[model samples]
Target: MEFKKFKLFEQMKPTIRKEFIFLLFAALITGGCRKIFDLPKEKDYLSNNINFSNKIFEPILGRTNLMGGFNADNSTMPMKFEIVNARFGDGRPVTDLFQKAPTYVWTTAYNGLEKSLEEIEAKRKLEEHALFEIRSSGEFIMWASANNSLIKPRPADSTNFPQDTRYFDLKITNSGGQTVIKDLQVRPWRERPYEPSNDMNLYTGGPAPDPDFPNNPNTRDYIRPFMSNVIGDATDVNLGTNDDENDVIVYIRPFTGGNGHSLRFKVLNKDSVAINPAAFNETKWDKLVHGFNMQKTTEYVQYDVAYPIPLVEVPTAYAPGGSRAHAELKYSRIGFGGGRVVATFGIDFAIYKKGDWEIVFHFKKDNPKFQND
Candidate 1:
C-alpha cells in the first residue's frame, strides 16, 4: 500500500507544478497592466459634461469667427480636439471643410498698438488653414474662406428651406483614450460687413429682412440721453418701417479716391441740404475722435486717421468702449415748455475695409429745431 501511494504522489507533482506556473504568469500580466498608462483613464478623468456654450454655430460669410466658451469641467489639459464626419443636413459630405485655404495667421503677439493696416498686416502671415478646424484645446474656428456657395444658410424668404446646415461630430482625445461628441450644428449666414447691422437679417442679399429702425434722440448713448419735445412741430420723427418715413439714416460709404486712409462725416437735413457742423454746438468735433488733421467744412467734417477706427478694440480717447467708435451730436434750444431741449444723434460704428469712408447722418423727416418755440 505504501509503494502505491508514493507512485500516486509522483503523478500529482507534475500537474501541481503546471498549475503554479499558470497562476504566476497571470499575476505578472495583472502587475504589468497597472504600470501601463501615465494619464487618467478616459472614463475616470474626462468630464461627462464637456460641451459648447452655444449649440448653433452661426459664422458670417467672408470672415472668421471663433466658436468659443467650451466648458470642460475637470478635464485634462492638452486634450486633442478634432472635427469629424462633417456633413450637410441632406446627408452630404462637407469635403470643402477639410480642404486648406489661405488665412491670416498671427506670427507675433498683437498688442493692439499697431498704427497702420500695413503694420497690422506685418504681424500676421498668410498661412494655409482648414476652413473649419478645431484646436487641440478645443477652440473651433470658421475660416474666412467659407463662402455662401459652400455653406448656405436659411434664405431671406420664409418659404425656402435651409439648403445646407452643416453638421459635424467632435472627437476629443486624451492620453488614456478618446471620446466623441456628436452632431454639432453649423448654420452660417452672409456677412453684413459693419455692425449696427440692424438694418438686415438672414442677410441673403435680399431686400433687407425686417429692418430695425431707431427713434430720434437715438438711444445709442446711455450716459447723457437726448431730450426732445415738439408740441407744434410737424416733423416726421416716426421710427418705423414705412417706405415714406425718414429717420436719421446713417450711411457708411467708402471711396477709393483721395486719401484712402481717412473718414469724413456729413449731415444732411430733410431737403437734401448739408447741415453746418457748427450747428451741433455741443459736439467737440476735434475730441470726438483720435483723428489727426481734422478738416471741417459746411458740407462735411473730415478726419485723416487710420483705416479701421479704434485700430484695436481698447478704450482710448477716441473709442470710449474699446469697441466701436462712438460719436454723439448734440444741439440744444428752447422748447414749448420753456425748458432747454436737446436733440442728440449718436452713432457707434467701425470700418473693417480700408478706404476713405464717409458717414452721412441724414435727418429725413425734417431739420432738427434749432430755434426757440
Candidate 2:
C-alpha cells in the first residue's frame, strides 16, 4: 500500500506543476497586451477642458487691457493658440484673423502728459494687433484697445445696449495634435453719455511776448501744453475771496544755460517775471512762488533748433486741497550776443484744486543772445 501511494504522489506532482506554469503564462500574456494596447497614448494626455482664466474682460474704449490667459489641464505639453473667429455682439465677424493693428502700451509710470515723444518711444512698444500669440509657457495675452477690438462692437446705444459687448473665439492645439476651442467675452467698462468735448479747463494769464520770440507773441508757438488730472471747467474754477488761501497761479519761462547755447529755467514762476510781471491781473496771480520738484537739465543747442529737455516731476492732486493749492510758476533766462541761437525746453508744473493739474511748458527761442554772466 505504501509503494502504490508513492507512485500516485509522483504523478500528481507533475500535473500540479503543469497547471501552475499555465496560470503564470496567462498572466504574462495579459500584462504584455495591456502594456502594448491598454496604456495611455499622447492623445489621452490632454486637458479634459481648456479655457481662458478670464471668461469676460472689461476694457475702456481708448485704453489698453490685458484680455486673458490660457488655462490648460496639461501644462507640460507645448501648445499654440490663434484667434479662429471673432464677432461683436451684433454678429459681425472679423474678416482677417491675422491682420495686425497698431496699439499703444504704457511701459513707464504715468507722469501725466509731461511725457515726451522720445520718452514714449523709448519706454513703450506697439503691439500690431488686438490678439497676441501664446507665450512659450502655453499662456496667451490679449492687448487690445476698445475702438480697435478684434471684433469691433457696434456703437453704444443707450436704448438698446448701453454697454457694448464683444466676443472672441480662439483655437488651441497641443503638440500631440489635439485641438481645443475657447471663448472670451469683452465689455466696455461703463455706459454714460460721453462728453462731446473737454477743453481741459485751460485759463491763461494772457499771452505776452518774450523778447527772444518777437516773431510770435505767445510761447505757445514753440511750446505745446499738456494738462493732466484737470476736472470741472475753467468757468467753475475759483480762487475764492482770499487770495492768500485760494491763489493758484503758475508761470513758465525759458532761459539760457551755462554754454549760452542750451536753454534752461531761471525763475520758474517761483518769483515774478521781470520781463512782463504785470501782464496778468492780481486776481489771477498767485501771491506765493514755488520751485519745481525737479529742474530742467540739458546741454545747449543752437538757435532755430528743436531740442527736448525733460519736464519736471509733479505730484498728482485729486479733488483739490493740498500744500500747493495756490502757487505760481515763472520762467526767465537771458542770453546776450544779439540773439545768436534759439532752443526749446519742456517744463512741468503741478497744482491742486477740485483736482490736480499738470502743465507742460513747451518753449522755443527764435533767437538768443550769448551772456558772459
User: Clashes in each model (backbone N, CA, C under 3 Å)?
Assistant: 0, 20
lDDT of candidates 1 onward, in order: 0.67, 0.37
Whole-model alpha-carbon lDDT for candidate 2:
0.37
Write the residue-wise lDDT of candidate 1 on 195-273 in tens digits: 5555444444533432243343233211111223422135534232133443556666675554877888888877889
Q: Model 1 residue 187 lDDT?
A: 72
Q: What is the lDDT of residue 353 in candidate 2?
A: 13
Of the candidates shown, which would achieve the greatest lDDT relative to the real structure?
A: 1
Which parts of model 2 have CA positions greater than 4 angstroms off? 1-44, 89-91, 96-98, 103-127, 130-154, 158-164, 176-179, 188-373
Residue 240 local lDDT, model 2:
22
